[model samples]
Target chain A: MSTLNLTAKAREAATSGDYSELISLVPYAKMIGIECIKLGDELVFRLPAQDGNIGNPTLPAIHGGVIAGFMEHAAQLHLIAAMGGQHLPKIIDFSIDYLRAGLYRDTYAQCQVWRQGRRVANVAINAWQTGQAEPIATARAHFKVD
Target chain B: MSETTIRPRAERFLSVLKHCQNLGMTVEQADSQGLILRLPYSDSIVGDPETGVVHGGAITSLMDTTCGISTVCVLPEFEICPTLDLRIDYMHPAAPGKAIYGFAECYRVTPNVIFTRGVAYQDDRDNPIAHVVGTFMRMGKVTQSEALTKAVNEGRA
Candidate 1:
């Protein structure tokens, strides 16, 4: 498929709430096995428990980098879904706080766009395993949206 | 600070960690000052296939791993020090098709926390791709499972 057509399809998928299609266009998201589920206008990301993601074999915990990456990808996809644009957002910076050791289980993340200006956007993201009340990690990211 | 003792332990720890192995990160140097790790170029880790630039996530992982390894080098014994918080600033996109190196130093090690600063670069140390500052909570010694211990010993051997 041509690049223009792919971008158009991705834009359409974003507007029509076909998150899976939109995510498919992102290579890193697919590489890390990020699954998207839409609830109303909000999108949640899921990272299935995979053995390859394990960092501490003794504790059998998911890699901290995997968690951070998953959250960052979630924020980027959230922006794409919200903006309905073909342009990929460039990350300016990312700050992540690891609240707890991510266990060897499926992890979920949600993003909140705090502000979307003409040239920049800020997003806050949280990831958890069992409950949203107890997040395993939280991250804030800035993106050059132009 | 015995370089002989800490260097071998750091190597063993990195070899045992699956995520570090997955990223193909190898320790380049470990001493009292800090630790340096190298991440070779791989197409599998490219974030933007069009430009073939390495993913920001890959660089973040490398920095985090490097910082943790540096912390281990400074500690007297093996312990599980999880990242409490990490902040990364992307100075520039890494040049495509070159191995990236991450230099990390644990500047402070208190009873409960370890502070680290790291920089990722490709060709020159002055021109870094990203800069990271992080704090890790010292969670005490890891429960030495036989499997984990055996892997560390084998790595040392």
Candidate 2:
């Protein structure tokens, strides 16, 4: 498999954001193997199999908490990129739209910074199965960048 | 004659669901889309005093487990299936005193891929507490006989 292009510094910056800290309080993402990569204006992440968000006999069906965890991750990555600094400005709120289902195998997320402001940056993201066209979900988040 | 086959992983899963059912979790519906697991709001489970509503984590557990079951229904041979991703939107706070049910459905099913979506509602689907979508990894399953054999060796079923 080709390696995904992202810097360790950018990733570390994202993993250390306040949004990441707040949600990590829950065990959902850690259990699912969620990972994020920041590339300039773009942010990518993987939703790994196995999580506490939800349980199922088939295993492909995941819980909502897992998704929320990634959303926060992507948002923070953008915050870090926009600020070009260690500390994230702030996150006012985040929201998502559920477009479809993702198999337990693995799903990918692509996030774009729509508007970056000194104080607030708006971000939009689309998540879907690796090989499919239709997005599993779309999300937009607002954050404050110092 | 061959020895009896049993799937310890599946059996162990059932015990967990049975506990939820005993607590009044209604994971009793299945349709063409997939399994529809429900969790009803009741006083015993809703320990929070302020709203008397079911806990978010408990509801998440229901969604997670049902998503897995939805995958299991399609592939009856896998020993395990894990979650890939899940997205849930809390449209409204859960009502503490009312019996709210979360209906989970698996939408996409492949040999190694599974997808599902579900929602939480108060009896009727017209009103819902949350919208949930999930992705699962079809880990793999073992047949009943294989399960029994594994149990014989592993000492835990």
Candidate 3:
């Protein structure tokens, strides 16, 4: 457990399958304003647009690295929620494909755990701004589960 | 060749990236080989509070930005190149309390795409924290193609 203490309510939420507390524990996620929501059995990540997130002011697009980071964080959170917090996965490698420029607007990501072995897991993630029909980026990540 | 001519252009290009400024990335060196960018240590980017390790996301940003800068150095004129794909492999956790540096080189540039490879290290180049390979889609008109050809000729000269 990290030294950052979660309120009893947050702990309760975690026990009830809400992962916002677990996501909040990550310092970078906090820096970038990442939020998690549980919709039925699915977990989705959201990143609200901020002035600091813009990489190219001319296009007014979100930074490519920021979009990649957000997707990576989403994969980690999805793994945590799936594993029931038994272990924290360490990223081994990440590959991202930028399909389109991430517009300066709210971005959402959904992760699908492709495989979860005893010692490793592979996750695929897609991020979209306007709708899921067209994703801004897609990523695949491998993590070491101990 | 003159600092008076190159420095401001580089600085002006970097100023447009707000996220780069937020991460406090600075151009440490730029030459024919490539460009080296430094990312100052910041607590705001720590991924593991327990170990105080900077987040991998920040390192990715640093390398991506370095690759972009390296492309600029290789090209004759500045152009907007969006990252088409990037792959990063982490070798080890970055040491806390030390600034990370990313050195990137553009290896190949075609009419529409640029290929780059980079390494992120805290202290020793041989001992890199991460290795990154990326492709960027070169946007804008083909006028810069002549500029790139001239730059290559100058390098060989």
What interface RMSD do all candidates show, one decimal each? 2.8, 13.8, 3.9
lDDT of each: 0.83, 0.55, 0.81
Deviation from native of the Cα of residue A52 in model 3, angstroms: 1.2
Ranking by lDDT: 1, 3, 2
| Candidates' RMSD to native | 2.3, 11.6, 5.1
Which one wins on lDDT? 1
Per-prediction backbone clash count: 0, 36, 0
lDDT of 3 by residue, B1-157 (tens): 4434344445556655789999898888877677788999988888877678888888888887888767776666666788999999999999988999999999998989999999999889999999999999888544534443333334321
RMSD of 2: 11.6
Candidate 3 docking quality: incorrect, acceptable, medium or high: medium
What TM-score does structure 1 among the candidates reach? 0.93
Reference-based lDDT, residue B31, model 3: 72
For every prediction, compared with the true complex, DockQ reads: 0.55, 0.05, 0.53
lDDT of 2 by residue, B6-112 (tens): 23333345444323444355545554445555566554444223345454545555666666555544554434555565555666667655666666666777777
Best model per DockQ:
1
